[model samples]
Target: MIELQGVHKAFGPKRVLNGIDLTVPTGESMVIIGGSGTGKSVLIKCILGLIRHDAGQILLDGEDVTKAERDAFLARFGMLFQGGALFDSLTVWQNVAFRLLRGSLKRPKDEAREIAIEKLRRVGLKPDVADLFPAELSGGMQKRVGLARAIAAEPEIIFFDEPTTGLDPIMSGVINDLIREIVVEMGATAMTITHDMTSVRAIADKVAMLHDGVIQWTGPVSQLDESGDPYLDQFIHGRAEGPIEAVR
Candidate 1:
């Protein structure tokens, strides 16, 4: 459902992405794994048009995203940001229903709240929790709230940025399972960028390792362990040395 061809992006003197070529098929979950500063998030932003690429093309469902209508094009996707990014001023339900309460997808307040509650339940949150604010929740709860919000609009595509970051092992496992379940249940195409290997194992149908600003390896998750690529092997095993240099 998404494709990037010869994509390149640079900021001033630094080159972040260099000719990235990758694809995510319809209803498939593709997880991108990479070292720090390898531009995983930048790749997603490029596709979303948040950071315009300097060259090449990004196509969504066969049409170039750069030429598409901004609002209408964006409505087809959802994002769960790295930090949860819930509104501090809004209640949990309000945060989840934010998109539904405004713009082309707007619904009546009561309707939006009901949908939010249902989404919360799907993410293993109780309706009672919906009335609480973000500050009152635990990290896991906040992540769930973010997940609920991402799926609230029933988007055809979803982007998960470091979904398991900053959570304990058990909580990370919960979030991984939740992400996998929701993506499959919704039958949506998913692209996730995360350094968490466990999250990649649990959530990805296919895995792509980004290095040196380009894809070094792309294959099914099952093949990751046996792929025999130095860069990928170093990353998945957390090796201190290989083709990838560990920063001191």
Candidate 2:
């Protein structure tokens, strides 16, 4: 449903993305695994049109959406940012219903609140929690609220950045399971970027590794261990001494 062809991006003197080619089919979950400063986040920003690529085509549903009709195109996606990115001033319900309250996709307040509560429930949050502020919730709860917001509109496509970062293993598992469940329930095309191996195993249908601003490997999740690519091996196994450079 989404495709990037020959994408390239640069920031002044530094070129972060070089010839990126990727595709996420409808209803499939693709996870990007890479080390810090490998341009993984840049790749995702390009997809969202937050960071325009210097050259290349971004096609959504067989149409070029790089500069034209971007608004209409972007509304199709829901994103859970790396840090949850919630509005501190807004209550939990308002945060989840932000898109629904003001946008071309806007819904009435009563309806929006109902949808927000339902979405919260979908992510295992009780309705009572919707009245609480973000600061009142734990990190995991905040992440769950972010998840609820992302799917509140039942978007056709979703982007999850570092979905399992900064959480304990058990909490990470809960969030991962919620992500997997919602993605499947919505049948939405999903893309996640994360370094956690547990997240990869839980959320990815396909895996792509980014190294040196290029895709080092792309394959099914089940084939990751047997890909015979040293880069994939080094990453998934967390091997310190390999082709992927790491300094002690």
Candidate 3:
């Protein structure tokens, strides 16, 4: 459903993505693992056209993403940001129904609220929580709210950025399981960028390791342990030694 070929991106003297090539088949989950500053977020931005690549091609279902109409293109995607990124001023249902309340996906306010409540339930939150502000919710609740919002629009593609960041192990596991289940049930193509190996193990059908601005290794999750690539080895095992140099 998505493909990148020889993609390149840089800011002044620093090059973040260099010759990146990846393919995400339709209705499958692809998780990208990499060290901090390795261009994982940049790669996603390039694909979404939030950041334009310097060279090469980004294709979404065989159509060039750069040339596509912005609103129409973005409407097909849903994203759960690294930070919960909820609107502090909006009530839970308002935040979840945000996209549905405006733009091309707009629905009647009452209908949007109903969909938001349903999505919230799907993410394990109850209806009573909908009228509360984000500040009233705990971190786990906030993250669940974000997940509800991501799937509320029923997007064809979903991107998860560090889905488990800041959650306790138990909550992280819950989110991982929820993400896997939602992707499967919705039949949405997913691309996630995260440092959490536990999330990778739970949510990925395929895994790609990004290093030095390129994909160093990519294969089925079942083969992850035996991939034998030094970069993948060091990153996955959290080894301080190996090909990756730990910053002091």
Candidate 4:
């Protein structure tokens, strides 16, 4: 459960998020769509407190968590980064179980390894792959490992950052299906940010389009095609000639 009200942020003279207001229900899957440099990622950072908002209210589960004890609050979340961002030194299992193996939450090594392998299987990875390092796997395999890592702690909320990016069409489809399954099977509240249309169709129950630093459209995924916002139309159809301005 998350809510943002009139959130505003800027970098020097360039305003990023003008006034972002959005919400995600306790167990809902909400995906945000937008072109690059539209402040989609910045919105996410604000929600997570990775970036400070100038003045606004961000409520997590009806509580004001914007300035709360951050780590205690953030422990409730898991995130799959766009680049996979795995450590080169740690094996796949360690990467998945990183938080579990260190600090006060540390579990027995054997127990952590077992949970890591189980999560890997849930993401359609073979058991033996757990022993390999990130560089040893292909890009698709790396993404699967990243998903496994994201869900390893079984956090109540999961944020997926471009889960289907940089892969071939088939691999992207595979990752999309895995994300959908995780959201449904775990009943985890999901917030995904991506530009991939296929990822939108597969992983989103509700869609919100971010443009010019605000949510221009938010609707059920089924109605996305017929929303009639020229910007949304241009984005989902991948058209070069519509209401969206080209980078020329």
Candidate 5:
């Protein structure tokens, strides 16, 4: 569903993504694992056209993303940000229904709220919680609300940016299971960027390791531990030493 070919990006003297060739198949989950500053987020931004790449191509369904019509192109995607990124002023239901309340996907107020409530339920939240503000919810609850919002618009593609950030192990596990289940249930093409090995293991159908501004290794999740790339080995096992030098 998505493909990147010889992609390159940089900020003045610093290069981020270089020759990042990868693909995410339709209705499957691809998790990108990398050390901090490896440009995983930048690659996603480049694909979304949030940041223009210096060279090469990002294709969504065989068409170049840079040339696609902005509105219709973006409408096909949903994103769960690294931070919960909820509007503190808006109530949970309103936040979930943000897309449905405006732009091309707008719906009647009543219908939007109903869909919001249903999505909240799907993410394991009760109906009463919908009226509360984001501040009233716990971290995990906030994340669940974000997930509900991501799926509320029924996007064909979903991008999860560190889905389990800032949660306890149990809550992280819950979010991982929810992400895996929801992606499969909705059959949405999924691309996630996270350093968390546990999240990678739980949510990925395929794993790609990003290092030194390129895809160092990519293959089925089932073959992760046996892939035998030093960069990937050091990353997935959390080693302090390898090709990746830990900053002191």
Candidate 6:
């Protein structure tokens, strides 16, 4: 449901993305794997129109996103940022229902809270936790709350940035499974960028490896091990010696 053709972005003298061509089909989870400073986050920001591309086109459902109405276009998607990004001032339910209580998607406070509570349940959070503030929760709980908020609006598309970044192995696994389940249950197109191989294995239907601002490999997750690409080999195995330079 999303496509990028010859996408290029540069910041001053540095070229961050160079002709990135990628696609995420409807109802599929596409995970992007790359080392730090390889432009993975920049690629997603380009697609989301947060960082406008210098050239090329980004199409969402066959229409150019650049020309679409900003608010209406953004409403079709949800995002879970790298750090869980919950509001310190808002309670759990209020944070989850942030979008629902504002803008074109606004609903009555009671209705929004009810939906928020239901989504929290979906992400394995109890209703009792809804009244607590973000600071009152553990890192994993905060991540779950972030996931609940992402799906609270029932978006057609979702973007997850480094979903398993700071969690322990067990909590990472939990979050990964929750992401996979929610994406499938909602049947929403998903694009995730993460360096965590375990998260990729658990959450990706398709995988794409980015290197030097370009896609080095793109295929089904099942093919990742046998893809025979040097870059993919180095990344998935965490090998220090490969075609990909460790020095960046």
RMSD per prediction, one decimal? 0.7, 1.0, 0.8, 1.1, 0.8, 1.0
Give the alpha carbon lDDT tens digit for every residue of 1-248 in model 3: 99999999999999999899999999999999999999999999889888889999999999999889999999999999888899999999999999999999999999999999999999999999999999999999999999999999999999999999999999999999999999999999999999999999999999999999989999999999999998999999999999999997
Write the residue-wise lDDT of candidate 1 on 211-242 in tens digits. Answer: 99899999999999999899999999998989
Candidate 2's TM-score: 0.97
lDDT score, candidate 3, position 191: 99
| lDDT tens readout by residue for model 5, 137-213 | 99999999999999999999999999998999999999999999999999999999998889999999999999999
lDDT of 2 by residue, 19-87 (tens): 888888999999999998889989989888888789988888888877558667778889999889999
Question: 3 or 5: which has the higher lDDT?
Answer: 3
Model 6 misplaced regions, further than 4 Å:
none
Clashes of each: 0, 0, 0, 0, 0, 0
Provide the global lDDT of candidate 4 against the true structure.
Answer: 0.92
**Model 6 TM-score, all chains together:** 0.98
Full-model lDDT for every candidate: 0.96, 0.91, 0.96, 0.92, 0.95, 0.94
- State residue 65's C-alpha deviation in candidate 6, in Å: 0.5
Question: Over the stretch 88-146, how does candidate 6's per-residue lDDT look in tens digits?
Answer: 99999999999999999999999999999999999998999999999999999999999
- Residue pairs that clash (backbone atoms under 3 angstroms), model 3: none
TM-score for each model: 0.99, 0.97, 0.98, 0.97, 0.98, 0.98
Model 6 sits at a Cα RMSD from the real structure of 1.0
